[model samples]
Target: MAGTSTGVLMAELTTTARATRVIAAVVGVALLLAGTVWGQDDKFPFGPFSMYAGVNGPNEPAPDTRVEGTDSTGRVIVLAERNAGVRRAEIEGQEGAYVDDPSRLARIADSYQRLNPGAPPLVKVALIVREHEIHNSSATGRWWDDVRAVWDRPA
Candidate 1:
């Protein structure tokens, strides 16, 4: 009798485990299908997180970017010259969202003001992006300069 009861309990446990696995698999399938069916920005399991996927996307050569400003005396002050605690990649990431916004330039100017207490105020600020053709890792040909965003604020 004891052996029979133990056997029955083991069978029950196996069935429960199988059922749980089946339910989980069903839910997983449902989620996968749902992701494929949803319209835009919802395809996660089967979609790319990048904006574009092609040779022109991320495979293109990376350009140099700078947050430059014209001081009150019309001198160009690059962010690196001020020794601001900022990185090029940080500005690169922000360029996507702040490229068309003027406040972003203003914010950079403010940061520069904080960094240089004795320097003259900035007359205009701009986020400049320069794209150069990839001609080896050391040297490149003439590139294009594009003013992605700018703000003119008088001190």
Candidate 2:
């Protein structure tokens, strides 16, 4: 009788241990999924330019400028100053305009030329982030990926 009881107790202990491990694993996976979902909702705030094309003064840097824009359909127009009398610009956008619009690139070039005609010629100007993340706490598992573009200038 004693031997049988001991064997039964040992079996129950093993079963309990397995159940605990499984529960832990499930909880870990659930937390991971929640974290990923939360991360996708994160947002970074951008800016408010004075003139669409002007000597816009410096602004705050946005968080994670390395990450590309989520609006893949929208275009990213970058104008950089290349040298004394030259500037470089590129427009990356969805496929429609490139095929249909003949004046788009020319318009951009003309705008830059008109804006900085006599000035140093915008030696280098590009679409860049000027803001950063503003977090209140250091707690782990907080999601952060959304981007908000505000028109108000930073103080």
Candidate 3:
């Protein structure tokens, strides 16, 4: 009788495990389908596969974004990951938001100050975009900076 009960319990557990796996797989597939249909960069992981989905036309300029600051001594500083503790990709991803409200850049300035205590305090921060001139889908070694937004430190 004991042996029969143990065998029955094992069979029941196996059935439950199989059902759980099937349910999980179905949910995963549903999320993938939904994300593919209606996801953007913000909805990453399951989002649309769009990092390289779009192609640029030959002879069109390619945008390169960077963050820069004007210090108290009037020296320009590039705020890269090492100095500012923020990555360029993070800034580029939210370029539109910064353009809409330049004041948001103050956070970056604060971060820069926190990381580099001896450096001159930033007087101004700006989001600049350099469009690299391209020809035949190749870089022409020419570019121009377009200042999208500037945030001046308050007195």
Which prediction has the highest TM-score against the true structure? 3
Per-residue C-alpha lDDT of model 3 across residues 1-155, encoded as one tens digit per residue: 22474465333457889899999999988888888899765576667756457777999899889999999999999999999988776788789999999999999999999999999999999999999999999999999999999999999
Question: Which residue segments of model 1 deviate by more than 4 Å?
Answer: 1-61, 135-140
Which should have the higher lDDT, number 2 or number 3? 3
CA-lDDT, candidates in order: 0.70, 0.35, 0.89
* TM per prediction: 0.55, 0.20, 0.71
Model 3: lDDT of residue 100: 99
Off by over 4 Å in 3: 1-21, 37-43, 49-51
Scored by lDDT, the top model is 3
Q: Each candidate's root-mean-square deviation in Å? A: 8.8, 19.9, 6.4
lDDT for each residue of candidate 1 in 39-123, tens digit (9 for 90 to 100): 2333556433233333433335656798888888999978864455565656765787677677767777777788887889887
Least well predicted 10-residue stretch by lDDT in candidate 2: 41-50
